[model samples]
Target chain A: MLQTLTFFALAGLVTIFALGTLVLRNMFHTFLSFLGCLLSVAGVFFSLQADFIGGVQVIVYAGSVAVLIVLALLLINHKSGDLSRTNLWSHKWLGGVIAAVLVGAALFGVIMFTHFTGLPLTGETAAIEPVPYIELADGLLNQYPVAFEAMAMLLLAALVAAIITTQADDKADKKAE
Target chain B: MEFVNNIFVNIADLCRALFVWLLNLLGLPVGLAEVAMVAVYWLGIVIVCVFCALFYVIWERKLAGYIQRRPGPNRLGPNGWFHTVGDAIKLVMKEDIVPDGADKNVHLLAALLAFVPPMLALAAMPFGEGMTALDLELGVVYIMAVTTLASLPVLCAGYASNNKFAMMGAMRVVNQAISYEVPQALCILSVIMVAGTFNLNQIIDWQTGNIWLVCLQPVAFVVYLITALAECNRAPFDLPEGESELTAGVFTEYSGMRYALFYLAEYCNMFVAAGLATTLFLGGFTGPFLPGWVWFLLKTFVIMSFFIWVRWSFPRIRADHVLTFCWKVLVPLMLANVLVTGVVVYLLA
Candidate 1:
């Protein structure tokens, strides 16, 4: 009963924050809302007993990715005066339609395909034990070694690419000077 | 000795029983008893966090004064014991100022949120034998995750303040936090490799069964200490709020209780870092005589004193040097430490 209530509460929070992210005029406020949304999603994951994934979600998305995005936003929009104007979309309707369609598709897919195992679909409370981290690690490293290694390689490539692009910018600045 | 060691556990059980009994007597659902117990546990942790912050703040000042051959905060009370309490009162009584140009909502929110990361990180930390508040299986990861968000509130404060200094400080915070987190995580990874578990309690158990992890992975221990100092924004890596350059950095525009919250959060983060070091390296709650909780506090205070000593002893490094050192020096060293530890653990297994 408590888990169900907690999950629904978090889901409500996620919805509110996600909407706030889209509806907020100021870019920074939008970012904060987006962060709230991410954290609430992580809370939902935790409610479902996916502790490892929840932790990674917070660490990766809310921690690194969100910070990077905000940093970039601040760098690009140096003037506080322009904060409100920066988040204005040129094609608002198109963007809204695209977002709506994507969300609808995701919802449709989940409703059609995914099985809600051990979840309290009805009003009955279910006891779901958390999956041990060791088994999770074993599955990732042994069962899906290729995918894991590939993901690492992809991240490394992205890092190197970022470094190269920044270096290239520095070189071009020197050339211009 | 055993009873003393398990004093907190016994108290906790007693409280739970009392709560359950009361709920039963009142004809209430027994499930609410667990929720009430959680609230009590949270209250206890809040008390611990506040006291830890207050004690450490005064201790840091006293240590700093001694380092400079002077008495610190001696006027407030005996040995300036009540200095922090007075300061807390003063902070509370002071005028709360929000800059006209600042985002008022974010400015206010930042102060409240600054307390979240450290408090959340504390939830996973094992203070003594069977004294963890949350006791999550992925305690290490949870700590790392929450601590990573420590930069977020600072960033919000900087951006909201509409001050260039605050903005610069926020940028440095993200830079330093992200950079140092690599080495810190890698250091923890090495310990995880040796312990073969992410659970903080199990890690402590592993240390108790064997030897302290510091002896096995000295490099990781040292690296962890350095990165932890950096992670907590302690000198000489305190570039984020470098007073000399940024005039209190992200805290430039904050005043009154809001500023106090930030200050308290910094000390709390330091305490959490020290607690983590004690757990990860100093064989948490393990020692002769005394009790588990006492040993834990002793170890944590020792680590915190070391932190304060380092803060006063060293000069702040350049921002670029800090990042360069983390990536060039600490990261590679920790990666090697992780690799070597992994290989050794595999062989032993």
Candidate 2:
């Protein structure tokens, strides 16, 4: 009973922060709310007993991604006056509505597809470890080695592409000079 | 020694037993009480972390003063033991300052973001065998991830301050943290491959009287030490709060308890980094005579003092140089260490 309550509380917090991220006028507040949402989602992960996932969410998303977003904003959009009245949804309400509908559809599809055997599982079902991260290493390294290798190859390609683009930009600047 | 070790280990079980007994007396099922008991365990951990932070700050100050050939905090209480206590009082009593045009909510939230990560990181850190708060399977990863979250608060504090120096400090910190994490993670991965598990206690067990990983994985140890220093934002890597140049860095606009909280987090982070280096490299909680927790504390403090020594003795490098060293030098070295360790472990296994 207590677990369920804590779960709802964290889920509600995530919902509130997610809405705040989208609804806030100021970009800075939007970023803060986004971080809050990310953290609350981590909290939800913790409540689900997926502690490893929770930690990764906070470390990668809340820590790196959110901080980078705010830092980029601070550097690129230094003047507060310039962002006082950002018309983010001025002419893109249709696009916003479409995105919202798509998200809703995806959520509905997930709810419909995934099996949710409501709480108080029988002995056999409840006996499972209730965590998936324990087998993630083996699954990634052995069971899905090809997929993992592909992902690594993609990352390496991206790294090479980034270096090439930056070097090319330097060359272009030198030539122009 | 056994008695002392059990005292720390039983704290969690004691809480559960006491709560279960009370819940039973109240004619309630003790099932839900387990969740509350977990909360009690966390409360204990947080309390211990705060006290440790206080003492560690004093020790760091005294150590730094000694290194500089100066008397450290002699006026507070008997060799300045109560110096941190006095600082705490002063901080609490001081006026809270919010710079004009600062983001009020984020300014307030920044302290919380800074303070919470180190405390949470404590949950995964084992003081002795079975002496962790959470004991998650991926204990090492959990600690690394939670500590990484600390950069967000630094970013928040800098951005919310609306000061250029604070922003610059935050930028430096974000870059330093993210860049160093790659090498740090690689170093840790090398250790994990050798230990063959992410459970910190299990890893320590691998080294109990056998051989400390520092002997087997000397290169990883060096990489881990350097990256750990960078990760914790300790000297040479403390460009985030570069006082000489950036003028107090991210906490430039912060005052009173808010500023103190950031420092508290910093000190606690130092302990966490030291504790991690101890657990991963030095055999954690393993010694000849004293209790496990005692050995753990001794090793962690020794590592932390080394960091303090380096902080005071070494000059801070330029920001670009720091990044270049991480990306160009440390990353390749760590990657090589990881590959070598993996091959050796595979052959031995």
Candidate 3:
């Protein structure tokens, strides 16, 4: 009973945070809202007994990536006037409608295809030991060793690219001065 | 032979009766005793998080003081043992400042983003046999994924403050963060060669009772520990908060309670990095006799103390220099370490 309540409460919070992320005017605040949504999603993962994935969600999505985005925004130092998401083309409402439709479709598909039909599981059907989420790691290393190594290589490239881009920008600025 | 069989049967009956008695006394219906068991398991987890957060702060302060040739805080209860508690109360009571034009909601939320990841990371960390909050199969990956949360709030703090310095600081941090994560995760995958499981408890078991991964995997340990320092953004790697230039970086605009929360999270994240280093490389609570949790805590505190020492003693490396070093040195070295661990594990197999 308590678990059901906790899950719904977290789901609601995620929705609120997601809304905040989209609608909040301040870029920084939007980032924070995104984080709140990520965290609540992590909570949902925990309730699903996907403990490892939950932790990763909290660490990677919430901790590193979200923070990185916010930090990236910070680097730009645009005034609210500078990037007032208000200046975008007039098709914003259409974009919103499309986003809403896509979300609804995704939800409907999950309900139709997944075991997550409206009803909660009875304890009898709640087969206890969680199916391993860690299979992703195994599948990554053993069956997909090339892909795994490639991710490492890609990250290496990201580092080099990030550095080269920043240094190039600095050099250009120096030349302009 | 009948007498011996009856003796075994009687022992089995006693065990069954005892189990029923235990269930009845546990405030659970007979069918839900396992749920009750889970509650008890998490109570221990709550205690570990609270205790570590509270004391680890004070310990870091002391270590910081010692390295700087000063007594950290000796006047509070018993060699300043309760100083952090006092600080907590002061922080809770402090009138938190929300700057004009600041989005109050995001301003508060930024601190939370910073605060949460370390707590989540702790759950996946394993101690001794049968000790952990929840061992998901993808423990290491989960931890790696959640580490992204640790940097978001800084960016939030910077942007929400409407300060250019904060923005510059956040940018510096973003660069540092993704750079370090690569080496850190690769190094851990190196160890995955031997353990064959992302479940931390299983990884520990693979390390314990004779074949500790650290002995076999020294380079991974070194690379992992260094990358962890960088990932945590501790000194030399702490370009985001470069006080000399950026004036505390993303945290410059924060004050009072909001500031305190971000401050606590930074120290706590250091503890997370240290704890992880302990688990992945240092035999992770595998020692003779002394309780496993005790060893885990002791090792973590030791690692944290080392970090604090280095933070104070070393000069902050330049931001560009940090980027150059991670790419030029740490990445290639750690990737090679991963290859070596995998090949060695295969050869032994």
Candidate 4:
């Protein structure tokens, strides 16, 4: 009963924050809402006893990714007057179409792939045993090596692209000077 | 000896029994009773953390004064023990200021959120034998995850302050934090590889059964210390708040109680870091004569003193140098350490 209540509470929070992320005018406020969304999603995972995934969610999304987004925001040189205008509704129809399609696809994936289990109305289900980290590691490295390596390569490519882009900008500035 | 070792465990059990009995008398459900116990545990942790932060601040000042050949805050109480108490009162009584053009809500929120990560990290920390608050299986990962969010509040403060210096400090914080975390995670990974568990308690048990990880994995221990110092934004790695350059950095616009929250969080972060070090490397809560809690605190204080010593002894490095050193020197070293540990573990298995 408590777990169910906790899950619904976190899910509600996640929905509110996710909406705030989209609707908030201020970019910084929007980012904070997005962070809130990510953290609440992690809370949901923790509620489900997916401790490792929940931790990784906080680490990757709320920690590294959010900071990266903020850094990018800070890097953009904008006057105080332009601050509020940054997140104004531009290309609204296109954005709406894209968002709708993305959400539809996610819903479709969930409906198609997820296995839903019915819970008892009263009392508690037996406590779920946590998967050990070693088995988790083995599953990633051995059972899903291709996916793991592909992710690693994708990240490496992104890192290299970032470095190259910055280097090129530096060279361009030198030439202009 | 057994009784001494289980002292905290006994106390905790007594509290839990009393709490459950009271809840039963109130006709609360079993599940609600358990939830209430968790809340009680969190309350206990918060109280302990606040007192720990207060103690650490005064301790850091006294140690700094000693290092610099001066008496620090000796006027208030014996060896200025009540200095932090007075400071806390003064901070509370002072005016809370939010800068003009600042994001008022975020400015306020940042101060409150600054305390969250450290407190969350503390939840996983096994203070003594069988004394962890949460005791998650993924304790190491959970600590890493929460501590990673430590940069967020500073970033929010910087952004909301509407100050260029604060923004710059925030940028440096993100850069430094993300960079140091790689090595820190890797260091923890090496310990995890050796101990064969992510559970902090199991790791401590492994250490008790064998030798402390510090002796087994000395390289990882040293690297972990450096990364931990960097992680906590202690001096020599405190470019985020380099007072000489950024005038208190992300904290440029903060004052009074809000600033005190950040200050308290910083010491608490240090305490968590030191606590992790004691658990992972210093044979947590396991010593000959002293009780487990006493040993844990003793080891933790030793590590905290080392952090303070290093802070006062060294000068801060340049921002670029800090990043370059992390990526070029620390990352590769930690990677190699992990590789070596993996091979050793495989061989031993």
- Using lDDT as the measure, the top candidate is 1
Each prediction's DockQ? Answer: 0.91, 0.69, 0.51, 0.90
Model 3 chain B weakest lDDT span, ten residues long: B1-10
Q: Least accurate stretch of 10 residues (summed lDDT) in model 4 chain B?
A: B29-38
After TM-score superposition, the amount by which residue A168's alpha carbon in candidate 1 deviates from its true location, in angstroms, is 6.6
Off by over 4 Å in 4: A81-88, A118-132, A162-177, B1-4
| Cα lDDT, model 3, residue B282 | 83
- Across B1-349, the per-residue lDDT of candidate 1 in tens digits comes to 8898898899999999999999999999988888998888888889988999999899999999998899877998788888999999999999999999899999999999998999889888898888998998889999999999998999999989989999999999999998898889888988888898889999999999999999998998888889889888889999989999999999999999999999999999988898999999989988888888899899999888989999999999998899889999988888888788878888989
Residue runs of model 2 more than 4 Å from their true location after superposition:
A81-88, A97-128, A131-135, A153-177, B10-14
For residues B1-349, write the lDDT of model 3, one tens digit per residue: 3343244235434554665678889765675645555555556555666677777778878878877889889988998888998988888888877778766776776776677677767767775545565666777777777666566667667666767777788777778888887887788888787778776777787778558777877887777777777777788788878889989888887877777777777767777787778887788877766667677778887888777777777898988888888898988888788777778778988
Better of 2 and 4 by DockQ: 4
Sorting all predicted structures by lDDT, with the top scorer first, yields 1, 4, 2, 3
TM-score of each: 0.94, 0.90, 0.76, 0.94
Worst 10 residues of 2 chain B by lDDT: B1-10
Task: Considering the two chains of model 1, state its CAPRI-style docking category.
Answer: high
Q: For candidate 2, state the interface root-mean-square deviation in angstroms to 1 decimal.
A: 1.5
Better of 1 and 2 by lDDT: 1
